[model samples]
Target chain A: MEEILQLVVFGIVIGSIIGLGSMGLTLSYGITKFANFAHGDIMSLAMYIAYFIVVDLGLMGPTVFSLSFGWGMFLAIAVTIILLAIFSIAIDKLIYKKLRRDKSNIVTMAIASLGVGIIIRAVVTMFWGPFARNFVPGIHEAVPITGNILIKPDQIFIIALTIVVTIVMYYLLYHTKLGKAMRATADNPDLAAVSGININNILAYTWAITGALTAVAGIMLGIQAQVYINLGFNLLLPMFAAVILGGIGNPWGALIGGFVVAISSEVSTAWIATGYKPAVPFVILIIMLIVRPRGIFGSNI
Target chain B: MDFLIIENSYLLLTATGVMNWFVGFLTTFAIFAIMALALNIQWGFTGIFNFGVVSFFMVGAYTSALFTIGPPGEYENYIMGFELPILFGWFAAMITSGIVALLIGLPTLRLQRDFLAIATIGIAAILRAVALSTEGFVNRARGMNGIPRILGDVVSGPDYKWVLLAITLTTLVIVYLLVEKITASPWGRVLRSIRENEETTKSVGKDTVNYRMQAFVLGAMIMGLGGAIWAHRMTSIDPEAFNDLFGTFLIWTMVMVGGNGSNKGAVMGAFLCCTFWFGFPLIQESLPDILGNKVFQLREISIGVLIILFLLYKPNGVIPEKPKISRHL
Candidate 1:
C-alpha cells in the first residue's frame, strides 16, 4: 500500500507536467489542424531558457515575497513564457507559414516540422553540448508522510500548479469571446471565416497561449527533475501517446490522458523492467488506435 | 617554365580528382538507388508511408556481420554469430530483414497514413532502444565490430573496393530495370491507382492492404540488400551507425528530390544529393580560415531550408515521374 501510494504520488507529479504539455499540444492541433511534432522540442527549449534565467543568472539567494526563497522561480517562469511565445510566433512565420501558403500535404508538413525539430535539437546541442542541468538548489529534500512514503516539495508544487493552470485554461478556453472564436475556427475554418472570425489572428493567439503553457510545463518539469537537450525528444513519444489516447484536439481529454499514461507507465515498471517504461505508452497508443481510433473523449467538431 | 608545368599539371590533377569523386559518388548512388527504388514501390506506388527504413537496413547489416563473423560462441559479450558462407549469409540477412518488416507491417498496414507513419517511427525507436540497452541482445551499446571482409582476400586490397563498387552498381542497375518493368506492368498500374485513390482501387476489387504489405516487404528486402553490400564494403558494424535520423530522412529526401514514382529520378536524386552531402563538407573545410567554419554551419542550415523550399516550390520533385504509356496497342 505504501509503495502504491508512493508510486501514485510520483505518477501524479509527472502526470501533471504531461497534462500541461499535452494541453499545449492539444490547443495547437485544435487551431492548426496539424500535429506539431516540434511541440516537445518547444518544451525543452523553454526549460533551457528558464534554467539559464534562474541558475545562470544567480537569482536564487535573495528573498522577495516575504516567503523563504526569492522569487527566482516566478522570474524564470515569466521569462521562459515570453521567450517561448516569441519563438512560436517566429516559427509560424518562418517555417509553417510558407508550407501553409503552398498548400502542402499533411505528410510534407510533418516532414518539414521534423526538419525544423532536427535543427532545433542540433542548435541546442551545439550550445549546451549535450549535458544536463538543474534549476532549483537543494531540491532533493523529501517530507515523510508515512512509513516508506515520502512527498517531495517540488512534486507538491507541480500538482498545485497543474490544477491552477488547468482551471485558468478552462476559463480562458470557454468563458472568453476570443476562446469562442478559437473554437469556431477549429470547428470549421470556412464557416468561421464566414462568421467573421479571423483565422490568422486566432491561430496566432493559439500559438502564443500554447507556447506559454509549454514553457510553464517545461519549467515545472525542470524543477521536478532535470533539464537536458534531449528532454523534450524523450517525452515526444509519450506526449503524443497521451494526446492521441485522450483524443486529438481535445484539451480536457489531454489532461486526463496524461495522468492515465503516467500512472500506467510507472505502475508497469513494477511488473516489467524500468527500461521498458517508454514502451508502455506506445503500446497503449497502438491499442487505442486499433480499439478506439477517435479516442476516449474525442468528438468530431 | 616550372610555373607553367605546375599549372598544367594542376588541371590534370583536378580532372583525376573529379573522376575519382564521381566514382565514389556513383558507388554510393548505386547503394542508395536500390533503397530508393524500394521506397518508390512502397510510398510512390502503394502509398504505404514507412518512416523506419533504417531499422531494416540496420538488421540487414547486423545479420550479415554476425553470420560472416561466426558464432560468438565463446564471446559472451556478443550474441548470435554462426559461421556461414558469404552468399548464404547475405541471402539470410535479406530474408531476415523481410521477415522483420512483415512482422511490423502486419499490424500496422491497417492504419491510416498518418498513423502508419507514427507506428513506423515507434518501431524504429524501439529497435534503437533495444540495441542500446545493456542487457538486451547484440551486446548493448558496445555494438558488434570487426566483421570479416567478403572478397578482399580474393582480390587485391586497392582493387577490391572498386570491384565491389562495380558489383553494387550492377545490382542497382538490375534492380532499377526490374522496378521499371514491374511498375510499367499491370500490377504496377494497380499500385499507382491505389496511391491515387485507395477507395477507388478497393472498389475495383483490388486488395489495397495486401498490395501495400507486398510493396513494404519488397522494399525492406531491397534495403536489406543495400545494407548487406554496405557492411561488406565497410567491414564494420555498430548500432550508432544506424541510429541517426539521417539514415531514413536522407533516403526520403533523395526520393522526393529525384522524383517519386520514377526509378530514373530516384537514381538521379540519390547520386546527386549524396555527392553534395559528401563533397560540400570537404569544400567547406577547405575554404580559407574565416569562411570555412561559417560554410559548414551554412551547409547545415541549407539542408533545412532546402527541404522546406522543396516542399513549397517543387512538391513533385525535380524530375517528376512520367506516366507509363502502353505500346502494346
Candidate 2:
C-alpha cells in the first residue's frame, strides 16, 4: 500500500506535467484542426532556452525551498515563455500559414508540422549537442509525507502550479471575450468568420497561449527529469495519448486524461520492466482507438 | 576479356576507389528504393497511411538475422538461430513481416487514417523498446552481430561487393517489375479507386477494407524484404538502426518527392534522396571539425525543409501520376 502511494504521488507529478503539455496540444488541435507534431519539439526548445539562460549565461542565484534552481530559473522561464510564444507565431507565418493559404488538407498540415518538428529538433541538436544537461547539479532529498511515502518539494510545486494554471485557463476559456471568439473560431471557422471574428488573430493568439503552456510544461519536465534534446520528442506520444483520451480540444478533459494515463502507466511499472514504461501509454492509446476513438469527453472545443 | 576490361573502366573505377564508394552508394539506394516502393504501394496506390514503416523493416531484418545466425555462443543470447540458408532467412523475413502487418492492420485499418498512422508509429516505438528491454529475447541493447553473409564461401574481399551488388540489382528489378505489373492490373485499379474516393469504390461493390488490408500486408512484406537485404549487406544489426527518422520519415520524403502513385517515381526519388543523404560525408570532409560536426544536424534540417517545400509547392511530386487511358478509348 505504501509503495502504491509512492507510485501514485510520482504519477501525479508526471500527470500534471503531461496534463499541462496536453492542454497546449489540445488547443493547437482545437484552433488549427491538425495535430501539431512540432508541439513537443517546441516545448523542448523552450526548455533549452531556459537552460541557456540559467546555466550557460551564469545567471546564478540562491536556491529556493528545496527546488533545484534559483531565481535565475524563474527569470529564464518567464523570458522563455515570451520568446517561445513569438517563436511559435513565427513558425506559423513561415510554414503553417503558407500551407493554410494554399488550402492544404489536414494530412498536409500534419506533415508540415512534422517537418517543423524535425527542424526544431535539428536546431536544438546543433546548438546544445546530443548530450543531456541539468539546471542544478546536486540531487535534492525527498520530503516525507507519511510512512514510506515521500514527495519532493519540486513535485509539490508542479502540482500547485498546475492547479493555478488550470484555474487561469478556465477563466480565459470561459469568461473572456477573446476566449469566446477563440472557441467560436474553433467550432466552425466559416461560421466564425461570417460572424466577423478575425481568424488570423485567433490563430496567433492560440499559438501564443499554447506556446506559453508548452514553456511551463517543458520547464517542469526539465526540473523533474533531465534536460535533453529528445526530452520533448519522447513525451510527444504520451501527450497525444492524453489529449486523445481526454477528448481533443477540451482542456479540462485533457487534464483528467493526463492524470489517468500517468497513474495507469506508473502503476503498471509494478509488473512490467521500467524500460517498457513508454509502451504503456501507447497500449492505452491503441485500446482507446479501438474502443472509443472520439475520446472520453468527446471532441468538443 | 574485352567485356571485363570495359566493365572495370565503366563500372569499377578502381584507381580512385570510386568503385567502392559507388557500390556502397548504390547498395544503400537499392535497399531504400525497395522500401520506398513499398510505401508507394501503400500510400501512393492504396492511400493507406502508415507512419511505422521502420517497424516492419526492423521485424524483417531481425527475423532474417535470427533465422540464419548460428546458435548463441557464450557472449550473445537470443531466441532462434536455425543456421538456415540465407535464402530461407529472406523468405522467413517476408512472411514474418506480413504476419505482423496483418495483426496490426486488422485492428487499426477500420478506423481513420490518423488512427492507423498513430497506431503504427506507437507500435514501432514499442517494438524498439521491447528489443532494447528484453535481455533474454533479442540479446538486449547489444544487438546481434556476425550473421553469415550471402555467398560468403564463393566470393572474397573486393570481388564480393560486386556479387552482392549484382544480387541486389536483380532483386530490385524483380520487385520493381512485380509492383509495376500489379499496379496495372484490374485489382490495382480498385486500389487506386479506393485511394481517390473510398465511398465511390464501396458503391461499386468492391470490398474496400479487404483490398486495403491486402495492399497494407503486401507493402509490409516488401518492406520486410528490403530490411532482410539491408541486414545481409551490413552483416550485423542493432535496434538503433531502426528509428523513425530513417525508417519512416525519409521513405515518406522519397515517395512524396518522387510523385505518389508512380512506381518509377518511387525508384527515382530513392536514388536522388540517397545521393543527397550520402553526399553529406563528402561535403563534411571539406570543412573544419566544428563545422563538419553540424553536418548531420544540417542534413536533417534540410530534409525537413525539403518536405515542407515540396508539400507547399509540388505536392504531387516530381513525377506526377499520369491518368490511365483506357485502351478501347
Candidate 3:
C-alpha cells in the first residue's frame, strides 16, 4: 500500500506535466490537423529559457516554500511563456503556414514537423551542450504524506499547480469567446470558416496556448526532475500516448490520458528493469493504437 | 619549375586519394543507398509511412553479427561468437527483419497512417530499450566487438574496399532488379493505385492490406541486407550505431529528396544527401574554433532544415516521378 501510494504521488507529479504537454500537442494537432513533432523540442526549449533566467540572471535569491525553485524560476516561467509563444507562432507562420498553403499531405507536414524537431534539438544541443541541469542544486528531504510514503515538495507543488491550471483552463475553455472559436475551428474548419471564425487566427491562438502550456509543463518537469536537451524528445512518445489515449484533439481526454500513461510507466518499473521505463509508454501506445485508435474520449476523426 | 611540377603532382595524388577515400572503397554510401532503395519501395512505391527504418537495420546488423561470430560452445563468458557462414548471416539478416516487419505490419497496416507511423516508432524504441538492457544476443550496452570480417583479413587498403564495393554493387543490382520487376508488374500497379486511392483500389477488389504488408516487409528485408553488409564491413556491432536521426530520418529525407516513388531518385537522393552528411565533418575541421566544434550539431540542424525546405518547396524532389504516357492510338 505504501509503495502504491508513493508511486501514485510520483506518477501524478510527472503525469500532470505530461498532461499539460499533451494538451499543447493535441491542440496544435487539432487545429493544424497535423502532428507537431516539434512539440517536445518546444518543452525542452522552454526549460532552457527558464534555466537561462534562473542561472544567468542570478535570480536564485529567494526560495519558493523551500521547493526546487526560486523567485528567478517563477519569473523565468512568465518570460518563457512569452518568448515560447512568439517562437511557436513564428514556427507556424513560417513552416506550417507555408506547407498548409502548398496543400501538402499530412505525412509531409509530419515529416516537416519532425525536421523542425530535429532542428530545435540540434540547436539546443549546440547552445546548451549535452548535459543535464537542475533548477536547484541540493536535494531536499522528502516529506511523508502517509505510512512509509514520502513525497517531495516540488511534486506537491506540481500536483497543486496542475489542479489550478486545469480549473483555470476549464473555465477559459467553457466561458470564453476565443475558446469557442477555437473549438469551432477544430471541429470543422470549413464550417468554422463559413461561420466567420478566422481559422488562421484561431490556429495562431492555438499555437500560443500550446506554447504557454508547453512552457509551464517544461518548467515544472525541470523543477521536479532535471532539465536536459532531450527531455522533451524522450517524453514525446508518452505525450503521444497520452494524446492518443485521450483521443486526438480532445483536451479533456488528454488530462486523463496523461495520468494513465504516467502511472503505467511508473508501475512498470516494478515489474521490468528501470532501464526499460522509456519503453513503457511506447508499449501502451501500441496497445492503444490497436485497441482504440480513435482514443477513449475522442470522437471519430 | 621542377619543384612546381612535383608540388602539382603531389596535390593531384592527394586529391585522388581523398576521392578514393569517399567513393573508391567500401563506402557505407552503398549500404545507405540500398536502404534508400528499400525505403523507395515502401514509401515511394507504396505509401507506408515508417519512421522506424533503423529497427530493421538493427535487426539486420545484430542477426548478421551473431550468426557470423565464432560459436559459443561451453564457456558462458565467451566472446559471444556464432561461427555461422557469411551467406547464412546475410540471409538470416533479411529473413529476421522481414519477419519482424511482418509482425509489426500485421496489426498496424489496418490503422491510420499516423497510427502506423507512431506504432513503428514505438517498436523501434522498444527494440532500442531491449538492446540496452538485454545481453543475450545484443551483448548489452558494451556491444559485441571483433566479429570476423566477411572476407578474411588477407586484402588491404583499396583492394579490400573494392571487394566490399563489388559485393555491395552486386547486392544493390539484385535489389534494384527485384524492385524494378515488382514495380513494373500488375502487383506494382496495384500498390500505386492503393497509394493514390485506397478506397478505389479496394473497390476494384484488390487486397490493399497484403500489398502494403509485402512492401513493408520487403523494404525491411532489404534494410536487413544493408545492415548485414554494414556489420560485416565494420566487423563489430553496437546499438547506438542505429540512432534514428541519421539511421531513420536521413533515409526519409533521402527518399523525399530523390523523389519518393522513383527507384533512381532513391539512389540519387541517397548519394546527394549522404555525401553532404559525411562531407560536413571534413569541411568543419578547417573552420574556426567557434564553428568547427559545433559542426556536428550544426549538421543535424542543417539536415533538419534541408528536410523542411525540400518538403515545402520541392515536394516532388529533384528527379520528379515521370508522368505516365498514354497507350491510346
Candidate 4:
C-alpha cells in the first residue's frame, strides 16, 4: 500500500512535467497548424540556457531575489522563459516563416524543423559534449507526510507550478482577444485572414508562449533527472503521444493527455520491463487513433 | 627526375586513398538510394508520411543476422534461429520486415496525415527501446558480432569492400528499374492521385486506405532490403547503429535533395549528399586544429541553412519531377 502511494505521488510529479511539455506542443500545433517536430528540441535548448545561468554564471546564491525557495525558482524560471521565447521567435522568423511564405508542403515543413533540431542538437553536443548534467545542485530531500506518503520539495514545486501555469494558460486562452484570434486562425487560416485577424502575429505569439512553457517543463525535467542534448529527443515521443491522445491542437486535452500518458507509462513499468515504458503511450495512441480518430478533444483538421 | 619522383609518389598515394573513399561513398550512396526510392513510393507517389523507415531497416538487419548466424549457444537469450543460406536469409529478412510494417500500418493507416506521422515515429522509438532491453534478442545493447561475411570471405581483405560495393550497386540498379516501371504504370497514377488530393480520390471511388497500406508495406520491404545489404557489409550490428537521429535525417535529406518523386533524383541526391558529408569532414580536419573544430560546427550550421535555403529557392528539388505526358493525344 505504501509503495502504491509512493508510485502515485511520483507519477503525479512526473505527469505534471509531461503535461507542461505537452501544452507547448498542443498550443503550437493549434495556432500554427503544423506539428513542430522541433518542439522537443526547443525544450532541450531552454534547459541548457538555464543550466548555463545557474552553473556557469554562478548565480545560485547571488541572484537579485533572496535565496528563499519560492524566490529562487521565480528568478530561474523567469530567466529561462524569457530566453526561450526569444529563441523561438528567432527560429520562426528564420526557418518556419520562410517555409510558410513559400507555401511548402507540411511534410517539407516537418523535415525543415527536423533539420533545425539536428543543428541545435549538434551545437549542444559540441559545446557541452555528449554527457548529462543536472541544473539544480544537490539531491532531492524528501518531506514526509504521515508514515506512508513522502514527497520531495522539487516534486511539490512541480505540481504547484503546473497547476498555476495551467490555470493561467486556460484563462489566457479562453478570455483574451489573442486567444480568439488564434482559434480563428487555426480553424481556417484564409477565413481568419479575410476577417483581419493577423495570422502571422498570432502564430508568432503562440510560438513564443509555447517556447516559454517548454522551457519551464525542460528545467523541471532536468532538475528531476539530468540535462542532456538528447533529453528532448527522448521526450519527443511521449509529448507527441500526449498531444495526439488528448487531441491535437487542443491545449486542455493535452493537459489531461499528458498526465494520462505519464501515469500509465510509470505504472506499466512496474508490470512490464522498464525499457518498454515508451510503448505504453504508443499503444494508447494507436488504440485512440483507430477508435476515435478526431482525438479526445480534437476537431477534424 | 627529382620533381617527377615526388609528384608521382604524391599522385599514387592520392589515387589509392581517394579511390577507396570514393568507392565507400558509392556503396553508402547506393544503399541510401534504395531506401530513398522506397520512401518515394510512400511519400512521393502515395503521400503517406512514414517517419519510421529506420525501424524496418533495423528489423531487416536483425532478421538477416539471426538467420545467417543461427541461434545463440547454451545460456543465450534470443529466439529461434536457423543457419539458412545467404540468399534465403535475405529473403526472410525482407518478408519479416514487410509483415511488421503491415501489422503496424493496418490499424494506423486510417488516421490523418499528422497522426500517422506521430504514430510511426512512436513505433520506431518503441522498437529501439525494445531492442535495448531485450537481452536475449540480438544480445541487447552488446550487439551481434562475428556474423559470417558474405563476399568478403571469398575475396582478399583489402579487395573485399569492393566486392560488397559491387553488390550494393547491383541492388541499386535493380531497385531503380523496378521503381521506374511501377511509377510509369497505372498503379503509380492511382498513387499520385491519392497524393494530390485524398478526398478527390475518395470521391472518385478509389480506396485510399488500401493503397496507402500497399505503399507502406512495399517501402518497408525496400528499406529492409537495404538494411540486409548494409548489415553484411559491416559484418557487425548493434541497436545503436540503427537508432541514431542522423540515420533518418540523412535519408530524408537525400530524398529531398534528389527529388522526392523521381528515382533519378533519389540516386543523384544520395550520391551528392554522401560525398559532401564525407568530404566536408576531411576538409575540416585539414584546417588548423582549433579552427578545424570551429569549421566542423559551422558545417552543421550550414546544413540547417541549406535545408531552409533549398525549400525557399528550389521547393521542388534540384531536378523537379517531370510531368508525364500522354502520347495518345
Best by DockQ: 3
Candidate 3 stretches with Cα past 4 Å from truth are B1-20, B24-26, B72-80, B153-158
- Write the residue-wise lDDT of candidate 1 on A83-160 in tens digits: 898888888888788878877656777777766766776666555557787664454668877887888766777888
Q: Report per-candidate DockQ.
A: 0.41, 0.74, 0.78, 0.61
* lDDT for residue B89 in candidate 4, whole number 0-100: 68
- What lDDT score is found at residue B215 in candidate 1? 83
Best to worst by lDDT, what's the order? 2, 3, 4, 1
Best by TM-score: 2
Model 3 agreement with the true structure over B173-254: per-residue lDDT tens digits: 8888888898888888888888888999999888889989998999999999998988887776677777878679999999
Which is the winner by DockQ between candidate 2 and candidate 4? 2
Off by over 4 Å in 2: B1-14, B325-329
For model 3, what is the alpha-carbon lDDT of residue A149?
88
Query: What is the C-alpha lDDT profile of model 2 across A23-55, one tens digit per residue?
Result: 999988878878887888888888899999988
Chain A of candidate 3 compared with the true chain A, TM-score: 0.97
- Candidate 4, residue A135: Cα displacement in angstroms equals 2.1
Ranked by DockQ, the better of candidates 3 and 4 is 3
TM value for model 2: 0.96
How does candidate 3 score on lDDT? 0.83
Winning model by lDDT: 2
Instruction: Give the lDDT of residue B245 in candidate 4.
Output: 57
Worst 10 residues of 4 chain B by lDDT: B1-10
lDDT of 2 by residue, B1-329 (tens): 00111223333345546767787778788989999999999999999989899999999999999999999989888999999999999999999999999999989898787667777878898999999998878887888898888888789988888898888888999999999999999999999999989999999999999999999999999999999998888878889878878899899999989999999999999988888877665566567889776988888999999988999889989988899888899
- Please state the interface RMSD for every predicted structure, separated by commas: 2.2, 1.1, 1.1, 2.0
